[model samples]
Target: MTTFDNLLLDLDTASGILTITLNRPTKLNALNSATISDIHGAMQQALDDEQVRGIIMTGSGEKAFVAGADIAELAGLNEISGRRFAEQGQDAFALIEESTKPVIAAVNGFALGGGAELAMACHLRVASENARFGQPEVNLGLIPGYGGTQRLAQLVGKGKALEMMLTGDPIKADEALRLGLVNHVVPQAELLGFCQLLLMRILSKAPLAVGLVIDCVNAFYDPERHGYQTEANSFSRCCGSDDFREGTSAFLDKRPAAFTGN
Candidate 1:
C-alpha cells in the first residue's frame, strides 16, 4: 500500500496478484529517475508480501504502456551521468527479472525504447492488439541503455533486434508476436483479465517449484551459469518439500492437489 508519486499499485490479495501501473500519461509514461525508483520499491513490496504471488505491469493511460525514457531528462545527461543513469535503471529491472514470483508485462500501447526494455525484463509479455514495440533510441542519436540491446537480441534473435535498433522503426502487436517478442496478443479490454487468469493458473501450482523453474530457465542464458546443474539442484530441493509429498499422494488417489507452497 505504499504511495508513489509516479505509479499506482493495486494488490489483489485474494488472487495474490499485484498490478503496478505506470502513471505520467502526459509523457506516455516515460521512464525517469523518480518513476524507476518507485518501480524498484513497488517490486520489493510485492516480493515481501506473502499474499503477492505474481505481478502485472502496465501503464495508466490507454495511449502507452511506456513510450520511452523521458527525453527531457536524457537530454541533460553527460557521459558520467548517462552511465550512472543506465546502471540505475538496469539495477531496478534486474529486480523484475530475478523476482521469485512471476511478472507479466501487459503492454496496452506503445512500448518504445526503455519501455520496451522494461517489458523485456518481465518473465512474460502479453500485448494488447493496439500495442507497438521498438528500440528507437537510434532516432535520438543514442542507443538503448536499459538492457534493451542485450535483451532484445535475446528475445527476438540478433538479426531482428539489429533491424529494429538500426532502423528505429516500430512494430505492431502481430509483428511482435511473430518475432517471439510477446507471449499473447489480446484485445485491449482483455489484456489485464488475460494476464490475471494466467497468473492464477501459475499460482495454482507449487510456489517453490515455480520459483526454481524461473531460476533455471534464466540461468540458461548466462555463459558462465550451468543450467543443468541449477535444474538438478532445484529438482532435488523440490523433492524434499512437503508439497512434493502431497502432489504425489493426490495423483495416486486420483484427486486434485492442494499445495501450500511448502
Candidate 2:
C-alpha cells in the first residue's frame, strides 16, 4: 500500500477492492495541488497492483465528497499558469478514466466544481441521498477546468449541462440520477457498501473481457478511434485469452467459472 498525505488508500485483500478517501475534511476535501498529486500517485499505485481489481473513491467526512477545488490555489492563476493548472488536473483525471479496472465514485455529499469533475471521471457513481452535484465555477468567475465541461455535457445532455454550469446551482441525488449523472442513490450509510457490491459483481466476470468493455466504451467517445473497430479488435483479442476458453468451457460444464484474469 502507498502512503499519501491527502488521501487514504484501503485495500480489501479478499475482494481486491481499493477504497480511496479524500482526507481534507477541513477544506471539504478540496482539490489542492498536493491533493491532486496524491490522487495521481494513488491511482498509479492501484493500476500497477495485480491484486487491485476495482476502486472506490469518496471523501472523509459526511458533509462532502469534495466541495470544490481549493479557491486559494485558483486565485493565483494567470493565463499561462491557468492552462497548465487545468492540464495538470485533466491529466490526473484522465488516468482515472482510462484505467482498465473499474472505478466507482461513492459520492456521499457535495460534489462541486473540480469535485464534480472527479466523480465524472469514474466508470460509475453511486450517490448518497444527501449528495449534491454541480459545476459552480461560474460563481468564481471561472469555468470547469478539469474536464468538467466535456464530461458533464457527455453524461447529461448539453442543455442541462449548460443550465447547471451557467446557473452555478447544485442538484440533489435523485435529480442527478435522472440526468444520468449517477448510477444509484441510496442512504448515506449505504453508499460505500452499495459501491463495493456493484464492483464485486463486475469483478466476478472475466477480467480481460471486463477491461475490454471499458476500452470499447471509451473508444466510442474518442475522436481518434472508431468505436466498432475497437470493439471488434477487443473481441478478437479476448477470443485468444485463456480466460475466454475457461469461461466457455465452464458454461458447457454448468459450473461457476473460476477466472484467473488470463
Candidate 3:
C-alpha cells in the first residue's frame, strides 16, 4: 500500500488487487492535471507490476467517485494547452481501457463527464446501488473527449448512449445495469466483496489467455482494422506463451494452472 501525493494506492497481494482511489474528495475528485498524471502513473505502475493480477479504480468520499474534469483549471488554458489536456486524458484512460489485466470501476456515487468516461475505459464496471452515471459534458457545451462518444455506445448500445449523452441525464445503478452499461449493482456494503469475487474468478484463469481475449475483443470494435487478423494473431501467439503450456498441463493433470502471464 502506498500513497502518491494526491492518490491513495493500495496493493493487496493476497487478492492481487491494486486499488487506486482518486483522492481529491474536497473537489469531488475532479480530474486536474496533477490528478490525471497521478492516475496515469498509477495505472502504469500496476500494469508493470507482476504481483498485481487485477486493478480496481474508485474515489474517496461518499458523495462522488469523480464528478468531472477540473473545469476551473481548464477554463484559463490556451488552445494548445487545451488540446494537450484532452489528449493527455485520452492517453491515460486509453491505457486503462487497453490494459492486459482486467480493471474494474467500482462506481460508488457520481460518475459524470470525464468521470463517466473513466468508468467506460475499464474492462468491466460494478456500481454501488447509490451510484449515478452520465456523460453530461454536453450541458457545458462540450463533448466527451476521452473515448466517451465511442465507448458509451459500445457499452450501453447506441440508443441508450444517445439518450444519456444527448440529454446529459444521470442514470442510477440499476438503470445502468439494466442498460448493460455496467455488469453488477450491489449495496455499498457488499460492493467490494462482490467485485473481489469476480476478480478472483478472472485471476484463476491463464493470464495470457485472458489478455488474448481482451485484445481480440477490443480489436473487434476498432473501426480502422478488421478484427480477424487481430484475433488470429493473438490466437497464434498464445500457442507459444508460457501460460498456454501450463494450462495444457493443468488440464491434463486435472489441476488448476499456475500462470505467470508470460
Candidate 4:
C-alpha cells in the first residue's frame, strides 16, 4: 500500500481487492499530466498483479471522485500534444474498461467533465448520494474529448445524453440512478463499504465466467463486429485460466473455491 507521487494504489489481499485512489484531493482530484501518468502506471500494475481479483477506483477526499482535468495542464499544451493527450487518455480509459477483471468506480462526489468520462470508462459505477455527475465541458467552450459524448448517449439514450451536454447541467445521484447512468447509490459514509460488498459478491462467482460476461458485452460495440469473434476468443481464453479449473472443481465438491486471477 505504498503511495505514488500523484496517486495511491492500495491492495487489500484479505479481500482480494485493490483500491486505486486518485490523490491531489486539494485539487479536487483533478487530472493533471503527472496524475494521468500515475493512473496509467497504476492501472497497468493492477492488470499485471495476479492476487488482485477485483478493483475499486475512487478519489482521495469526500469532496470529489474527480471534478475534471487540470486546467493548468491543458493550458500549456499545443494542438499536436493536445491530440496526443486525448489519445493517451483514451488508451488509459480503454484499458480500464477492457480489463479482464471487473473495475468499479466508487464515485463519492463531483464527477464532471473528464471525471464523468472516467467513470464511464469503468466497467461499472456506484455512487454516493452526494455525487453529482455531468459533462459540462461544453460550457467552457469545449466538448467532451474523452469518450463522453459517445458513451453518455450509449448509456442513457441520445436525447437524454444530448440534453446534459448541451446545457452543461449536472444530475444528482438519484437522478443518475433513475436514468441508468449509475448502477447504485448509497450514503457517502457507506460508499467504500458498499463497493467492498459488491466485490465480495463478485468474488463468489467464477472469475472466468465473470470475465466472459464483461468481454461479451463490450464486444457488441467493437467496430469490426468482430465482437463475436472477440467473445469467442475470450470464452476460449477463460477456459484455460486457473480460476476456471478451480470453479468447476469447487462446484463438484460443493465448496467455495479460491481464485487467483489466473
Candidate 5:
C-alpha cells in the first residue's frame, strides 16, 4: 500500500482492482506538477504489483473527474518550461495508456484540457450523466499539450475534435458517448461501481490474453509496427501459454476455466 500526497489508492485484493482517486477536491482535482508525478508513481506501483489486475481512475468529489490543469502553475511557464511540463504530463499519461492491465476512467464531472487528456489516456471511459468533457486550452491562448491534440482526434475523429478545441466548448456525457469519447453514461453514484463491474468482467478471462490484446490493439497506432503482424504474433504467443491449454481443456470438459494468468 504505497502512499501518495495527491492520490488515494485503494486496492481490493479479492477482486484485484485498484481504484485511484485524485485527492485535490479543493482544486477541482486539477493536475498540478506534483499530482502528475504522484499519478506516475502510483501507476508504476500498480503495474508492478501482481495483486493489481485492473485500475479505475476518478476524482475525489462529485464536481470533477478533473477540471483541468492548475492554471496557477501554468501561469509562469516559458517555452522551454512549457515543453518540459507537457512532456512530463504526456509521459505519465502514456503509462496509463500502455498499462498491461486494463485502466478505465470513471469520469464524474468536468474533464477539460489536461483532464480530458487524462481520461483519453485510459483504455476505456465510463462517464457520469453530469460529466462534461473538452479540450478548451484555446481559450487560454494555448493548446492541449498532454497528448490531448493527438488522443482526442483518435477517439472522436478530427472533425469533432477540432470543433471542440477550436470553439473551446464542453460536451456533456451523453454527447461524449455518441462521439465515441466515452463508453457509457450513468448516474454519478453508480460510476465507480459500473467501472469496477466492467473491470471484473474483463479480469475473469485469461490475463495473458487480455494483456496481449491490449498490446495488439496499441500496435495499430504505433508507427513502427504493423497491426496485423502484431496480432498474429500475440496469437502465436498465447497458443504457447498454459492458459491456452486450460481454456481449451475446460471448454471440452463443460466446466468453467480457472486461469492463473500463466
Candidate 6:
C-alpha cells in the first residue's frame, strides 16, 4: 500500500503474490541508492504481510529489468562512501536472498551489473527471450559489490563467473539458461505470466515447508552451517505442524490438502 518513487508494489492477496516493478523505465530501471532503499522497504512490507506467500520482481518497460546501478551516484563516491554504498546494496539484496516467501525475477530485458546481482538474489529467475545478463562492473573499474561475486559463482560455476566478470560481456537469455543462471527463458509477453503460474504452483503447497526448504538450501552455502542439520531440524519442525497432519490426512482421504501455514 505504500508509494515509492523508484518502484511500484502490487499485492494480489487472492493469489498470495506481490509483484514489484522497478519503475524508472526512462533510466532503464537502474538501482540508485534511493531505489535500493525502496526495494528494502518493499521487501520488508511483503515479509510482514501474511497474505504475501510469494513475490515477482520485474521492470516497468520493455527495455530493461534493470540496466545497472545509477552511474551518476557511483561517480560521486569516495572510498568511505563507496564502501557504504556497497554495504547498503548488500543489505538490501540480503533481504531478498533470505526471504521465506519465494521471490522470482521476471527479467524482461537487460539485467547487468547490480541488476544481475539482484536477479541472482531471487529464489529463481525467468528471463524473457530478449533478456541480457552480465556482471560488467569491471568495465567501471569495480568488482560486483552486491554479493554478485558470491551468488554469481554459486549459480554458475566459478570459471564462468570469472569469465563473465573479467570480460565484462553480456549473455543472451538462452545462454543464461544454459549456464543455469536463469531457470527459464520465454517470450517477453509470457515472462510475467509464466513466473506467476510458477509461484501459484509453489504456493499451493505447505508454506512452512517451503520456507524451511529455503533455509536448508541456503545453509548449504554457509561455511559455518551444516545443511544436513538444517534439513533435519526443518523436517522435525514440519512434522510438528498442523499442515503436515492435514497433508497426511488429505492423502488418506483422497482430497486436496488445505494448509493454513501453521
TM-scores for every candidate against the unseen true structure: 0.98, 0.99, 0.94, 0.91, 0.99, 0.99
Superposition error at 148 for model 1 (Å): 0.6
Better of 2 and 4 by lDDT: 2
TM-score quality measure for candidate 6: 0.99
Question: Which runs in model 3 stand beyond 4 Å of their true positions?
Answer: 1-3
Global CA lDDT of candidate 4, please? 0.88
Model 2 misses residue 219 by how many Å? Answer: 0.5
Relative to the true structure, candidate 5 reaches a TM of 0.99
Query: What is the Å distance of residue 112 in model 1 from its true position?
Result: 0.2
lDDT, residue 212, model 4: 83
Q: How well does model 5 score by local distance difference test? A: 0.95
Candidate 5, 1-262: lDDT as tens digits: 8899999999999999999999999999999999999999999999999999999999999999999999999999999999999999999999999998999999999999889999999999999999999989999999999999899889999999999999999999989999999999999889899999999999999999999998998899889999999999999999999999999999999999999998
- Worst-scoring 10-residue span by lDDT in model 3: 1-10
Residue 8, model 2, lDDT: 92
Clashing pairs in 5: none
Worst lDDT run of 10 residues, candidate 5, spans: 213-222
Candidate 5 residue 67 Cα shift, in angstroms, is: 0.3
Indicate the residue-level lDDT of 97 in model 6. 91
190 Cα displacement, candidate 3 (Å): 1.1
RMSD of each: 0.8, 0.7, 1.7, 2.2, 0.7, 0.7
lDDT of 6 by residue, 1-262 (tens): 7889999999897898999999998899999999999999999999998778899999999989999999999999999999999999999999999899999999999999999999999999999999999999999999999999999999999999999999999999999999999999999999999999999999999999999999899999989999999999999999999999999999999999999999
**Candidate 2 lDDT, tens digit per residue, 1-262?**
8799999999999999999999999999999888999999999999999999999999999999999999999999999999988998999999999999999999989999999999999999999999999999999999999999999999998999999999999999999999999999999988888999999999999999999999999999999999999999999999999999999999999999999999
